[model samples]
Target chain A: GIQVEQSPPDLILQEGANSTLRCNFSDSVNNLQWFHQNPWGQLINLFYIPSGTKQNGRLSATTVATERYSLLYISSSQTTDSGVYFCAVARGSQGNLIFGKGTKLSVKP
Target chain B: DAGVTQSPTHLIKTRGQQVTLRCSPKSGHDTVSWYQQALGQGPQFIFQYYEEEERQRGNFPDRFSGHQFPNYSSELNVNALLLGDSALYLCASSSRQVGYGYTFGSGTRLTVV
Candidate 1:
C-alpha cells in the first residue's frame, strides 16, 4: 500500500494572500491529482499534474515525481477558497487513488 | 455534459441495516470507482468497476460490494452496516482511453444510528 501525507494539516490566510500546500508520497505514483472540497462537499478537480507544473487561474500545482512530492499553490486567495485541499495519487495501473488527509484552508476577508 | 451524478445525497439508517448508493459516471467515461471519506479524513478507495465487472478492489470487507451496468452506471451496497459505517461515499469516473484523472460526484452522506 502507498502512503500519502499532506503538510500544514490546517492553514489560515487573509484575503488576497498566497499559500502553498505540500503532499508527500511513500512510493512512486503513476497518477496524481489536486482537488478542492467545497463546503457543500463537492470534490472539484484542480489539476492532474502527475509531473511537471501547471497553472489555472489563481491555482497552480507542481509535482516532482522523482522526489515523490507535490505542491499546490493558491494565490490572491478569496473567502470562497475556504475548504479542504486534497492531494491523491495512484501508484499502480488500477487507478485507485490514495488520498492525503488534506490541508484545511480558511481564508478570511 | 454532466459530470458524475450520485443519488440520495443524504441517508440515515439503523445498525445492522442494508443500504444501496447509486452513481452515474461522467459522459464518455467508462470506469467507475467508489471511495469512503470519514469525518475529517481523506477518501479511501473501496473498489472500482469496469466493463460491468469488478476490476480492482481495496481493503474493504465482503459486506461492501458493487456492480457496474452497461451504460457505465454503478451501485455500491453495504450490508450489515455498523455505526462506524457512517461516512461520505464518493463516486469518481474516468476514461481508461483518456488515461487521465477522475471527476468526482458530490457524494452521499450516510449516517448509521
Candidate 2:
C-alpha cells in the first residue's frame, strides 16, 4: 500500500490570491488525480495528471512521477474555490486509489 | 448527458442492520467505483467494477460487497453495519481510458444510530 501525504492541512486565502497545494506519495503510481469536494459533498475531478502538467481555468496541476509528488495551483482564487482539495493515486494493478487527507482551502470574499 | 447518479441522497440506519446503495454511471461509461468519505477526511476507495465483474477492491472487509450490472450500473451492499460505517458514500464512473477522468456522484450520506 502507498502512503499519500498532503501539506498545509489548512489554508486561508483572500479573494484573487494564489496558493499552491502539494501531495507526496511513498511509491510509484500509475494513476493520479486531483479532486475538489465542495461544501455540499460533491466530489469533482479537477485533474487526472499522472505526469507532466495540466491547466484548467485558474487551476493547474503538475505531477513529477519520478519524485512521487504532485502539486495543485490555484490562481485568482474565488469564494467558489473554497473546499477540500484532495490528491489520490493508484499504485499498481489493484487500481484502487490511496488519497491524501487533503488541504482545506477557504477563500474569503 | 447525465453524470453519475446515486440513489437516496441520504439515509439513516440502525446498528446491526443492512443497507443498500445504488449508482448509475455516466453515459458511455463502463466502469463504476465506490468510495467512502468521512467527515473532514478524503474519499477512500472501496472497490471498482468493470465488465460486470469486481476488478479490484480496497482494504474493506467482506461485509462491504458490491455488484455491477451488465448495463454498468452498480450497487453497494453493507451487511451488519456498525456505527463506524456511517459516512458519505460516493460513486464514480470512468471509461476504459486512463486519460478519461472519473465523474463522481454527489454521494449518499448514511448515518447509523
Candidate 3:
C-alpha cells in the first residue's frame, strides 16, 4: 500500500496571506486529488491534479509525479478557506485512494 | 446533477447493536465507495462497490459489510458495533473510466454509546 504524508499538520495565517501545503507519497500513483473538508464534514473537491499544475480561483496545485510529491498553493486566503485539506492518491487506476492525515488551515480575518 | 446524497445525516446507536447507512451516487456515476473518518483524522477507505458487487476493500473487520444495488446505490451495514465505531462515514462516487475523480457526499455522523 502507498503512504501519503502531508506537511504542517496545522497552519494559521491572516486573511490576505499566502501559504503552501505539501504532500509526499511513498510510491508512484496514477490518481491524486485534493479536498477541503468543511466544518460540517462535507469533503469538497479542490483539484484533481494527478500530475502537472492546475489553478482554480485563488487556489492552485502542482504534482510532480516523478518525484512522488504534490504542492497546494493558496493566495490571498479568505476566512472561509479555514478547514482541513486532504491529499489522497491511488496506486493504480482502479486502486483505492489512501489519504493523508491532512493539513488543518485557519485563516483569520 | 446531484453529486452524492447520504441518508440520516446523523445517527446514534448503542454498543452491540447494528446500524445501516445508505448512499446514492451522483448521476452518470456507477461506482460507489465508503470511507470512515475519526475526529482529526483523514478519511480511510472501507470498501468500494461496482456493478452491484464488492470490488475492493480496506483493512476493516467483518463487522463492516456493504452492498451495491442495480441502480448504483449502496448501503453500509455494521454489526456488533463498538464504542470505537463513532465516526463520520463518507460516501464517494466515481465513474469506471480511468483517471476520473470522485464526488463525496456530506457524510453520515454515527455515534455509538
Per-model C-alpha RMSD: 0.9, 1.4, 0.8
Q: lDDT per residue, candidate 3, A1-109, as tens digits? A: 7989999999999999999999999998988999999999999999988899999999999999999999999999999999999999997766788999999999999
Q: How would you encode candidate 2's per-residue C-alpha lDDT over B16-77 as one tens digit per residue?
A: 99999999999998899999998988888899999889998888999999999989999999
Worst 10 residues of 1 chain B by lDDT: B94-103
Question: By the TM-score metric, which is better: model 2 or model 3?
Answer: 3
The pairs that clash in candidate 1 are none
Task: Please list the residue runs of candidate 1 whose C-alpha ends up more than 4 Å from where it truly belongs after superposition.
Answer: none
Model 1 per-residue lDDT tens digits across residues A56-89: 9999999999999999999999999999999999
What C-alpha lDDT, on a 0 to 100 scale, does residue A61 get in candidate 2? 98
Candidate 2 per-residue lDDT over residues A14-97, each given as its tens digit: 999999999999998988999998999998899988899999999999999999999999999999999999998886533777
Off by over 4 Å in 2: A92-94
Clashing pairs in 2: none
Candidate 2 total steric clashes? 0
TM accuracy, model 2: 0.96
The native-contact fractions of the candidates, in order shown, are 0.84, 0.77, 0.77
TM-score of each: 0.98, 0.96, 0.98
- Model 2 lDDT, full chain set: 0.92
Predictions' DockQ, in order: 0.81, 0.65, 0.81
- For each candidate in the order shown, give its overall lDDT on alpha carbons: 0.95, 0.92, 0.94
Better of 2 and 3 by DockQ: 3
